[model samples]
Target chain A: MSTEIAIHIQDIHKEFLLSHSGSASLKTALLWWKRRQLEELKVLRGLTIEVKRGECVALVGRNGAGKSTLLSLLARVYKPTSGTITINGRIAPLLELGAGFHPDLTGQENALFNAMILGLSRKEATARIEPILAFAELEKYRDAPVRTYSSGMLARLGFSIAAHVDADILIVDEVLAVGDFAFERKCFAFIEEFKQKNGTILFVSHDREDVLQVSDRCIWLKDGQVEQEGDPLTVLDAYESGTA
Target chain B: MRSEFQELWRFRELLFAMVERELKIRYKNSVLGFVWSLLMPLATILVMWLVFKVFLRNDTPNFSAYVLAAYLPYQFIQLAVLDSAQSVLISLPVVKKVYFPREILPLASVISNFIHLLLSLPIFFIFLFVIYATYGFEVSPFTWRMLFLPVLLVITFMLTAGMAFIISALNVFYEDVKYAVSLLLYIFFFLTPVMYFSENVFYALKDKPYGMLLYNLYHANPMAMLVTAYKKTLVPMGKIDPGGGEGLIPMLPMNWPMFGVTVAITLAFFFGGYALFNRMKWRFVERP
Candidate 1:
């Protein structure tokens, strides 16, 4: 593993505009034209962290603690209002599985499309179809439209496609929690292999045991700022006792 | 913006996949499938020909060909803009989860519709040939001027893409942008010279004081110029030989100045749309 930084976060601040009413509708938008009130919700406030190359960093936080927001920023899904996030390599973000899948498209077709969107060429994606299908254990149902798929099946397909992307860094946000036990174990095995190959990982999870097993370091977030950061067991202990 | 376009180019494969996905989804679960692309414009041409030729009794020679040349391109723009207006809003899940050039969503819609337009071109040519052979109407032979068809198609594409970018980005905030675009298309359909000829508008108000101004202004619409250019290229005008005899071949009355203006306007629309979209795109992730 290179001793360079894989992910760098510097003084990142993010603010979300909360509309008082459902202003997307033209009627409400017109009605609120003059008196519209927008509440700015600061999700992240001057928070900064860095993950070295080949490091597995777990982000553990309660609901609404900005875990998802921080991951989204790292994935470049949203720009920070006032700070910077620098990622040195290609990113494969397993945020919400099947979020880009067209429900009307068949599993095979959706997999091809999703893989291409994730940065694989058509030839590369086609070459990996067999392995992807095998990993998802969904070879028989490849022809069915995803609308007919169960949530678990959809997650499996999404995970399979994302896992195949040739990426230097992987960002996982609670996606493994939706899979079956065997699938979760398979995902961890793949993560272990990925770690062995010196791939950097940033993950958000509520599962304490999974975090301790997968991550060498942990960052505990509270009220949109880092509450603790150290070895996984130490931070987890501090986070648990602080919450309790 | 240059880097943005470069990034989009790097993800060109994704753009192509998105376009393929859209085309596939549109035809899925349908019996006729891609044939609908041909049948739709053909059906519209048929009804338009009937109303103009039989009901209204408008005696425009080669009426089917004329209506088709204008209507096909107009339909392409209409469908592209309308569909793309909702592209960002419809892909909210992907927009919020994944990180790629956000412009690719609406651009994919525009490209798919451009493919549909390309497919329908053969139908237009067939209509021209049929009308020329059966009705004894003089049809222009393929000429260097015919090369302008691709140029016209590209301009139409750029114009539609620009509008799509602006409308789709706005749609992330105001859902009414889609309806507004539909309403604009409805009104714009009449403003362009699809149903009538630019010459007729000129001839009708020839004696008025501001007749020439109105005439020039009417033809100044970029869409009208495109439609007229398409008609000139496809629908031929009977020309007289110097020997006081009617010529069998047709000639196009090329309007180079109007075309230049249309090209300029299209470039403006393309750049303006991108400017507006890039400016408003940051708010997209913050929207619900």
Candidate 2:
């Protein structure tokens, strides 16, 4: 496997059926031929991009410009209707903080659960549990059910688990715009350290400062296509002007 | 489809983790944590015993033993189906955000209840041990054929997992699936022999013109076949002694040909369910 290119998405397209939306009833489900009434909505159209190893690429776009869909595609939440997505490493998708947390589970348990979901073995997750709790600053509340934790506390724990996964590519989707200022800074600091480790990153965010600070390069998406690509400041400025 | 299996295999540890979470959360807030799982079956036995022996003057003899074989597997299937119908809906937030094989949610619920099934087997054995100890060993419930217990259990699991995959996938598409599953299970409870032997059904319909055919066709119901198999294997001779000496109601021989057909049907259902789930999985988060 070539380790140089981290993610190579070529001419990918995605379509979703707008009708026959759900199998809410036996009648609808049994009427198989009637499902052809579905209206197809193409969310992503012929989008292609490649990220080199150890690059931090930020995606900036207006609402409904297909940024979220593209990140989700990279995260494998949804597959492409056609085209190829070849990736060369472990992927830790931080699409939303507390992505798989059970409110009734304690901090320690949820951390172990999240680590395993992010592709760690029980033994490995156990080994890192102590560090994850310490980093999240939830060591004192480790045994307490996470339902009792504040929203900020939940995001902190969520971010802490993703940080420990040692993933080759990280798909972060606007999760930093959460928690208190101090914790947000800590998360940013971790992202900087992650970048220093030659980790590839594809991130989506509406925060201008966060984008400029974290991304090495930037791509602007509009109407399911790449509108512009260049240095972080230039693309971010262009995206800002176009949206304005 | 093959990659989905491999992905699920790679995430097998997560399956364990999810099952653990389910069992833990189920009883976590209660004073009696794990014992509550035991109490459900115990209470059920007590209720059914009261109904059969005390109230209706219906004497089936060791009715608790009779119901035990059917109840355990029925509870496994029922619990799995009910929870699996809500599995995706409850995890909708996570599904929208993160990516996993997504089958793990339903599978974890099924397996946790399966664990409950395993745990409750001791109670059945203990109940039988006491019964046998009091009433001489001449009427032992278990036979050497009990060795087929594991095979029977796996078949039950396949039937359960197959149903779990389908309902859970359907639930993601339509929230109505949860309600329909509950309604169906309530009706299905009567159809499965949770209260009486499957033989009772066969005997009831024996006088009808199409009786023999219907009786033979009855085994085709996966639940009917499984529960009967369990009862026959675990409690070979079901003799009713309502304080008066009575003869064992000898269990009919295992219907081998019917059993073969039932297994085939269960396999087809299992594969069909897996195929349906995979086909609908990608569209789970799609909204027009």
Q: DockQ of each candidate's interface versus the true one? A: 0.63, 0.56
As a TM-score, model 1 comes out at 0.94
Looking at model 1, residue A51 earns an lDDT score of: 94
Docking class of 1: medium
Candidate 2 lDDT over residue span B241-288, tens digit each: 332233345556888888888898889878888889888887788732
Where model 1 places Cα greater than 4 Å from the true spot, the runs are A1-3, A27-36, B137-144, B238-252
Chain B TM, every candidate: 0.91, 0.92
TM per model?
0.94, 0.93
For residue A145, give model 2's deviation from the true position in Å.
1.3
Which prediction has the highest TM-score against the true structure?
1
- In candidate 2, stretches whose alpha carbon ends up further than 4 angstroms from where it belongs are A19-38, B1-3, B239-249
lDDT of 2 by residue, A1-244 (tens): 4779999999989887777445445666677876787777787889999999999999999888888888888878888999999999989887365867888888899899888888889999999999999988999999998889998888888888888988999988889876888888998888888889999989999999989999999999888899999899999888888889
The digit string of per-residue lDDT tens for model 1 on B1-288 reads 798889889889989989989999999989999898888878887898788778876656677777788888999899999899889988888888788888999999999999988988877777777777786644443446667688788888998888888889988888887888899889989888787665556556667899978877877788888887787776665431211132222333666887888888888889898988988887797874
